[model samples]
Target: MRQLLYQLIFFILLGIPDGRCLHMVNFFVPEFANRGDKVILECGFSVNDREEELYTVKWYKFDSRGKMSNFYTWTHSNQQPKKHRIEGVKVVMRESNQNFVTLKQMKIGSSGTYKCEVTSKRRNRNPKYFHPNENPPRFNVIEEEAKLQVVELAREPPEIQGGRGNYFYGDDLNLNCTSKPTYPPTTLTWFINDNRVGNSLIEDDLLYKDDDLYVTISFLRISVQPNLFRAGEIKVRCVAEITEEPIKASMLPDKKEFKLYQVKLPEAMKLSTQTIFDVPLFGDGCTNKLTKFILVIILFLNFMF
Candidate 1:
């Protein structure tokens, strides 16, 4: 229809007739930043005219209440907002590219609708025509609102006590681990050197208290022991898993180390006037003395001395 109108105008202006052509250029400014942020508004030009003409461009901003304001202007002599408020926001022509506008250090008050207005200039005509429709046609520049959020870091586990005792191989070992509660409850797992242990039974009896600030008390009860087990310093470890990583507090052995010892008593006691010399040197029998001969000899030696 615009081409038809231009052809009709050309027929009226001159004696030539041409087919109709309709061209519409739309403005688009998708999103903007908040205060202390940067933004770039784009405005492109499209023309449908037989005569090549020069185009003039300008930018405006509108608010939610439909209040319009001239935030930026682009033409032969560039014009910008005069209010001291927008001084921090520097609008650059984007390296001599008239179609794009770059604003830096944008402020919250600069949030509004922006329109890129372009006016075209014809060589022979005094009246200028804007390539983009100036009426109800403009790009909107809007500043997004900021929001505040609080994030709590993972908490440390509490000190553990009791539950220490002799654990025979294959006997069930139950250990209690506790910690402060965390958002999206922390994942818990038990590991034996890198092997994952299941928690179906332990999770069943997990208790919570203290305004739920206290984390889920995990009771790890291992029903089986590995083949490397012994009464020696077998590292009985309790690892609490929060997140994918493990936070561990091992079960240290008591101060006194355990050792196996054996003691054998003599089958019978030998009684004689003289000392028995057939007893083994390392046997318990060496610790006891024969009575009659030893006592009499000791008395005679004392009298001689």
Candidate 2:
């Protein structure tokens, strides 16, 4: 009776529930990653007793839609790791092992929750913990999971349309700004003379594309004023960016800005008129009509005299 009580006390002290021997020690997974980047996922575990041996290690993934599937597995008996074919998951064989995996060229579709499962089994019975009359589970499994987010940034700068020409006072300025297709769609903002425009003057549109990407478009409409022009030109800027918490301090947000200059209507009209009238009409086989008429009259007088 005293030996059974001691064994119960020992089990309680060790906090071993349901004869589980494998314990997760550490799990390392990056929360954010850019597209086409390489990432490493690591799992560390320990067994409660020396008689327990590692049986197998498996890695599973749950996509954004909560569909679960196994991607990789390693068994102690085989001493080799095997990879399963899955879309958007490229495992580097030379860099992966039983405890960690290296994934290269990550894609936006790789965003999901990843689980690491470790299983262990007892090869021999421990005299102190195991009794002939008591039955225990042969295998124990422990699992840990982490979420990862993969993003694709815009490749080009923002584009501004419909604001290319000159603007006059009291005329309505209508412009549209568009950003390249990217994951987690970019945000478009409008600025006039360095002043940010409010939502009332802006209209937003989003276009969905293949591979879970989006193209963002924004429209700006406001009445042109003399104060908007500085030094005979108006500065119109459109900025596109992705707003999210940075995973690293050195990682900056993806941003692109495009600016266009619109000349004042009067300045543009003056330039147009100068371009039209600046050429001499009397050059190269052309002469002043008044001078020609005077010369003809003088010749006529000379002939009469």
Candidate 3:
């Protein structure tokens, strides 16, 4: 009898071939987390047979040697929080369907490998090593692990600055929009008179880190159109935004430069006039024959008188 018990123990401790469980479970974990936010790691399992067999969950962390150190456990509708845990880290079982562990107030040090394990509960009947509610018989075991990343938020908005120049029609227009160093990088979009710039235009964005923050600078380069530039400088606005952030980016003038030109009248388009053949002007040396004849008649009449 003792030899048979020893053989059973050897098979149980040594595990089956490949040491992998037959059941499968999916894990829902974020690739990264924002600082000061809640990070929820979920373990999802679907029982195709609709079996409601009692199950227990345990969450652990793997060391550099790939060894698991248990930090939290769930049994009998209760959970145990992790040891050496950061502030606000706890295990929460919502809907009694799956396992979920929430890490609160995440920081840079919170980055690490985390694992979730689930198993079916069974009664340990042996009297010599009998225990209640601890290390119950486990079957159909499944495990999943992931690496968590944390990032800080950047609160400042981006600044858009336009180059100083007396912009004229057909002149090259240049504008620069610089963003404050921030996490997750900032996005800068160029607009002219509320119209968005297209990808085919001369525009580009550059990013660099300043200390621990990320800064982005977007530049606009395009030849000014005649109708787009007018009496004054064109109003080109630089808008900056972060995709994950809830707040809107700082506003730059949404200005467009329209070109203006003077219109001239052609000679063919002027008013038409009629021609005059005998137009006379005073002090001209032209002979007045009628005036001489009248003067001779007047002298003869005077002599007869």
RMSD of each: 24.3, 14.1, 23.5
1-305: candidate 2 lDDT, tens digit per residue = 99999999998986544365678888988877878899999998988666588999999999756888889999989879999988788889899988889999998788889999999977545556766467554788899999888777776677777753343456677888888876656677777666788999999876656665667778888876656666655677787766332211111233333221121122211210000001112211133456678899999999999
| Over 4 Å off, model 3 | 1-35, 40-57, 60-81, 84-100, 107-115, 119-121, 126-140, 143-157, 163-173, 180-184, 194-205, 208-213, 222-225, 230-233, 241-305
Better of 1 and 2 by TM-score: 2
Q: Best to worst by lDDT, what's the order?
A: 2, 3, 1
Report the Cα lDDT for candidate 2.
Answer: 0.71
**What local lDDT does model 1 show for residue 70?**
58
Assess every candidate by TM-score.
0.30, 0.66, 0.42
Over the stretch 1-305, how does candidate 1's per-residue lDDT look in tens digits? 99999989877866332222212244456442433445666666654364323345556665545665555555534443222124233675443244566776554345445665665443332236534444333222212122111112233533233344444444455655554453212444444433455656455222332221224455666543444234322343344333322223222134333221111112231111111111111112222234445778999999999
Cα displacement (angstroms), candidate 3, residue 244, comes to 11
Predicted structure with the largest TM-score when compared to the true one: 2
Among all candidates shown, the one with the greatest lDDT: 2
Off by over 4 Å in 2: 1-21, 126-137, 170-172, 230-233, 243-305
Task: Note the Cα lDDT for every prediction shown.
Answer: 0.41, 0.71, 0.54
Worst 10 residues of 3 by lDDT: 275-284
